[model samples]
Structures are given as C-alpha cells and as structure tokens.
Target: MGGFTLDDILATRKPRDSWWTVFMVDPLACRLALLVANHTSITPNALTRLSMLIGFASAAAFTEGMLVAGAVLFYLSFTVDCMDGKIARLKGTGTPFGLWLDYVGDRVRVVCCAFGWGFGEYTRTGDTDVVLAAVGVVVLDLFRYINGPQLKRVKDATRALLETRLEGQYVLAESVLRSRPRSELEQAAAEFEQTAEDTGATVVDLQKAFHARFPWYDRFRVFLVRHRVRTHVVSGIEFHAAVFVVAPLFGAAALVPVAAVAGTLLLTFEMFLVYRVWLASRQVPRTAAEREKILV
Candidate 1:
C-alpha cells in the first residue's frame, strides 16, 4: 500500500515558502512527490542526485545557446529539487548527508548556470560585460549562502543563551511571586519553568519570544505568509528564477540588466534581514563567550 495520500504530501511543505516555490515550483513538485513517495522505492537522496543531474543539463543547455530548453530544464530541475525535501520530511527518512547534498547541489547549479549563460551570450555578442555579470552572479550567490548558515548559527547560540537566562528568571519568579507572572513573557517563561521542572527535560521554545518585542513584526510576517509567500521577497529562489527563467525570455540583451537588477534586489532584502536579526539579538542579553567572540 502507498505511504501517504496527495493531501499528505502537500501538508509536508514548509509552513511558509518563498514566492517562487509557492507560486511556480511547489504545486507541481507536491504532485510529483506524491506519486514517487507512494509508488516508488526511490529515496530522497536519489531524488536529490537526479535533480542535480537535471540542473547540470540545464546549465549545458544554456551554454549551447538553447535558451528555451535551458529555461524549461532549469525550472524542471528546481521542481525536482523541491520534491526531495518534501519526500524526506514526509517519510522521516531525512539525514544530515541529504541536507548537505541539497545545499551544495544548489550552489553548484547556480554557479554552472551563471557561467554557461555568460559564455553562451558572449560567444554570440562579443560583450565582455556578460562575463562580468556572470562573475557578479557567482559572488552574490556565494555571499548570500555563506552568510545564511553563519547567521543561523549565531541565532541558535543566542537562543541557547537566552533560554538559560529565562530559566533563571523563571526560578526567581517561582520563589518570589508564587503567583501569576508580571508580564505575558514572564507568564510563558513561568509555564516553561514548571514543565521542565516536572519532566526534568530541556525546553527550547520561550513563548512570547524574540518576536514579542516587536509585535508588529509578527503581524507583518503573518500577513505575508497568508498570501503564500515568505517575508523575503527577493531571496535566493527569486534571484535564480529572475536570472535564469525570466531573463531568457527577453533575449541575450536583457540578461545582464536582469541579473544586475536581481542581484541588487537580493542584496537589499538580505541586508534588511540582517538588520532585523541584529535588532532581535539586542532583545537577548549576550553571554560572556558571545561578547568575547565579538571582540575577537
């Protein structure tokens, strides 16, 4: 018998998705993932490998000046790429190796496609700017991805430190008040405290968390998510879709400008995201190790 229904596959998707995946990629990926998960013995790692091969083929198509083929192939590759994650989450078969492969595969695909497009157009037009645009694409893509993991690491560390402090606050509140906490934040921290004390386990989520500081931010996020798009409007997914899928329709002359505009938009959103993260960090007091690391 099959593992999951089509509805089950759809439910395996992220709580929120980027605009490109939500609108362009996921609908088809979900349907395909449904079929593969139910009917085939194919694994998530295998799907990832297949997606990488398709992506490489798309890059090759671009290099050969097959714009229509390249665009279709790239879109197809992305759809398959989306499917692997869904299958992994749905089947509980995900591994650290699969995650690493997916991340590295995405970077390789972008790099290959950028170089292929630039070289193909340059061969026909003799425009050196295309080469520069290609290089810029590689650098910008690397910049975003490199920062993302590091930022996530920092956020994780901050949360750990914040949790410890909240635990302290919870203990003190219990000793002193023995009643309702002062604020909503204290109310949540107190509850978490009681649960952990009863179970002797770790509690990760501090309700009324970092977002609670800026209530409007939560509302903004909900509003965007309600429309099926994440707050990051021009993230890596949108950047690739713009450069590879959308730009090709306008011919070689449009590629550089399209890539340039895409890069700018990506940077703008990314920097804004960094600023928001910094502000969120300020809400949580730093630990001694964090302070020392910053100094170094």
Candidate 2:
C-alpha cells in the first residue's frame, strides 16, 4: 500500500472521477505515481511545481504552432497534475497548501494554453476569432471553478436548513444521484419520500423535475456511472482536452469552432444543474420570517 505497484497507487483515486481521468489519464498516471513514489522522496507540492512547468512548456509548444507536439505536451502536463494527487493519497502527504498550489497551477495552465493556441493560430492565419475563442475558454473555466463549488455549498446549506426544521435526517436528490448507483438512488429517494410521509423527514429532490419528464434518464445515468462518468459528460476537463488536443489535430481552422462547441456543451449541462438546484432549494420549507427575509 506504499504505492510500490500501479494498482496500489490507483487505489488512491476518488470513488468517482472525471471519465477522461478514469479512462485516459489514470492508466498512465498510476504507473507514474508508483514509479515516483518508490524512487523519489518528492512531496506533492514539488510534483505540482513540476506539473506547472510542463504545462508552461506545453504553452510554449503551442505558441510555436507545433500543434501535435503541443497536444502531447498538454496531455503529459495533465498526467503529472493527476499523478501528484495519487502520490499524495498513496503517501498520506496531502496538505491544504498543496491543494491550493494544485488549483492555482491548473488555472494558470488553462490561461496559458488558451492564449497559446489563440495567438498561435492567429499568427498563422491573422483571424481574430481565435483570440475570441481564448477569451471564451477562460470565461468558461472561471464560471466553472467559481460557481460549481458555490452551488455545492448552497446545496449543503439547504440540506442543513431542512434537517434543522424537519428534525430528521434528509436525503438530498443531488447528493444521492451523484454518489449512488441507479437502483440504490431510486430506493433512497423512495425511502426518503416514504419517511417524510410517516415522520418529520423532508424530501427535496433536485432530480425530481428532470426524472419526471424523462423517466429513461436513470438508464443513461447508469451507463455513465458504470464508466466512472457523470451525467455532465462535457465538463471542463473534456472542454480543455477538446480545445487543446482533439481540435488542434485538425489544424487551426478547426480550433476556434471546436472551442465554441466545447464551451457550449459545458455551459448547457452546467446550467441544467444550476436550474435543478434552484428548483430543489425552493422546496425547502421556510418560516414566514425567513421567506420575508429572502424577499427583502
């Protein structure tokens, strides 16, 4: 369990993760994590620093219009970024400062790569749209990193409020869906509703509206979860890969359009979650004074 083997290192991964990581990144990262953990006494923060340097090198590659080389370097940079996490989990050397370093490194890499490809392609063709694509990519990344965590916070606060008012543990739809299998999710939702009917438990399903309209969605969710993918298939991770790796393979003209498509897909699914969270929050029972305060 000291990360002497690839599987030992891989056991450190989150229960569910980005599908790209589960499929593409983890395969290479686990082995690398094992190698580094066994040989080097490198701290996670040190690995984070190395990752940022590789990411900057990727940006340099992109600036030179070495499209394939840039793509490869970008992937390698992300591989190192992921490896740091696994190595930390394996060695139990994780720290809050390391988390901060990792987060900052990721944002910086995104910014560098965005402008890297934008200016690189702009130089090649003198098309200003590529620059716009870079701006859009950064905007999307900002919205995700900022709003996503805040949404989770709001959901947690709502759950706290409900459990306080109702005097029983409440099962939230969003939490259950994200963490459980389809059958277990349905059972949990049903049990929550039944408990609410019989006692003081409050039921708030972020998924209620969506599931009612599209009953077949659990099947899709099952398929995605089986692959360690989530309902939001085109997350920021995929957006970055699509922009930096997949689109560039087709050359500069494809870069801007692919970025646009990737950004659109990311926002659409994110908006769906935001709306559902809002809807679910409304179902939380509030005292008249609390409702008045909200209105004020």
Candidate 3:
C-alpha cells in the first residue's frame, strides 16, 4: 500500500488558491504534519470534508444567534479551509477530483451561510437583509459559474507562456555552461543574455500592443483578472454581511442605506468584471492567432 506524503500534495501550483492562505492561522502546520508522517500518508480530501463540517457548524451558530461563538467558528472554518490545500500538498494526493470538490465545497459553504443568515434574520426581526444576502450569494455563484471556464483557460494560457519562457532561458543557460571553447562560450553567454532580455522585452511589448488595441477595455480587464481567491467585490459583500449582523443588534435604521450602498457597489463591480471578461474572450482569438506565428 502506497501512502501519500504531504509534500507530494503541496507540489500542485494553484495560483487561485493563494487567497485562502491568508486566512490561515498556522500556515506551517501542514508542512509539520508532512514531516511527522514521513511523507507516507493522509489525504487533502479529508481535511476538505472537515473544513466543510466546521463551516456548517459556524453557519448554524450564526443562525442560532450565538454571535461570538459563530464568529469564532467561522474563523475556524476559514482556517480549516486554508489547511485542506496545504494538507493536499503535503500528502501528494491533489487530484482533479479533489480540486473540483474543494471548489464546489466553497460555493456550498457560501450559499448555506447566506441562507442561514437570512433564515436567522427572518425569525428574529422579520428583516429582509437575510433574503437580500441570499440573492447576493446566488448572484456571486452565478458570476463564478459563468466566468469559471474562461478564467481557467486564461490561467492555463498564462502558465504555458511563463513555462515556455523559463524553458528557453534554461536551455540558453545550459549551452553557455557547457562550452568547449572559452571565447565561444563567452560569446554564446552574451547572446543568451540578449535573448533573455529580448524575450522579456517582447512580453512587455505584447502587453503594450494588447493595451493599445483594446485601450478602452484594458484597465477593466486588468481589474477583473483575479488569479487568486482575493475578490474586489467580496469586500463589499462582507460589508453588507456586517451590516446585516449589526443592524439587529443596534436597532439602527441607518444601516439600510449602508447596506444599499454596499450592495450596489458589489453588484456594479461584479457586472463590470463580467462584462470585461466577455470582452477579453472576444479578443482572444485574434490575440491567439497573432501569438501563434510569433511563438512558432
């Protein structure tokens, strides 16, 4: 029986997953676990399941009006959420299925938590923030679902370009290192350096070219290009969540306006991101064809 070590799982490069890493309390725990287990066994999926359970408990606490307990539990849930990927990395068991599971699990947690908050509010004060939050959650999920594949494609393209550049540089470096004649080697080394410099220049030039062609949409594209889990709009969503949490406790009618502003900002940002993504997708074919000849 082959057991998985933590190091193996952590080897997967997931740029999108890095945002959750910030929420973690003990970043090195997974690495430590890998050391103790001798790289032999443990699955990231298990940790993912555990995180989901903890997240559900946190949502339940919030629904039951245990604000302090709920906050603690939610933070714990977020921490576990960070650990699951780390555990996967340590165990070397990071499969596509596991990745898919983690993605779906995140959406489920968000949706369930939103619903729980809504239900809690409805029971307590017959307020509608909970319902609005639920709608917002659905909207967020819809945005993700619509853009997920396109984003993944873009990520893959970026990775390919980076890897190709690295490989080219490596080959050039090796040629310089294994020279039969010193003078020729020096010349080759200089050429290699020039090639590297040119490659970098080309990348910047291409970016500039892309911007020139799509000047109006370039800034919008840049803003929407979130490789990590860090979301610009989620900040607004979190603010709305805070409003919902505080309004009942304070009996403040002013929160309604605050909620409205936050919600509008979040939706506006989301819409802008979606539209930019659509525009970028439309531009991809032309960009791809131009790059193909250059790359070849």
TM-score of each: 0.81, 0.87, 0.57
Report how far residue 232 has shifted in candidate 2, in Å.
1.7
Q: What is the C-alpha local distance difference test score of each model?
A: 0.79, 0.82, 0.53
Off by over 4 Å in 1: 1-3, 168-219, 286-296
Which residue pairs show backbone clashes in model 1?
A: none
The C-alpha stretches of model 2 lying farther than 4 A from their native spots are: 1-3, 173-206, 291-296
lDDT of 1 by residue, 1-296 (tens): 47788889988989778989998888899999999998897888999899899999989998988887888889999999999889898988888899999999999999999999999888988899999999999999999998888778766656656666665332322232223233443465556667677654433332234455656655565566666677888999999999989897777878899999999999999997787667656656676775665423
Number of the top candidate by TM-score? 2
lDDT of 3 by residue, 1-296 (tens): 33545545355334433233433433454454445345435577776787689778867875776655655665566566666666565445667798887877777776666566557656887878656755675565556465657666764454455445444333322234332233244566566668777554222122333345556643343333343344343453254344444333443343345446655665676665555444444432345654584334
lDDT of predicted model 1: 0.79
Clashes of 2: 0
Q: Which candidate is the best by lDDT?
A: 2
Whose TM-score is higher: candidate 1's or candidate 3's?
1
Residue-wise lDDT of candidate 2 within 55-142, one digit each (tens)? 8988898889988888888899999999888888888888989989999999999999989988988888898999999999999999
The stretch of ten residues in a row with the least summed lDDT in candidate 3 is 201-210
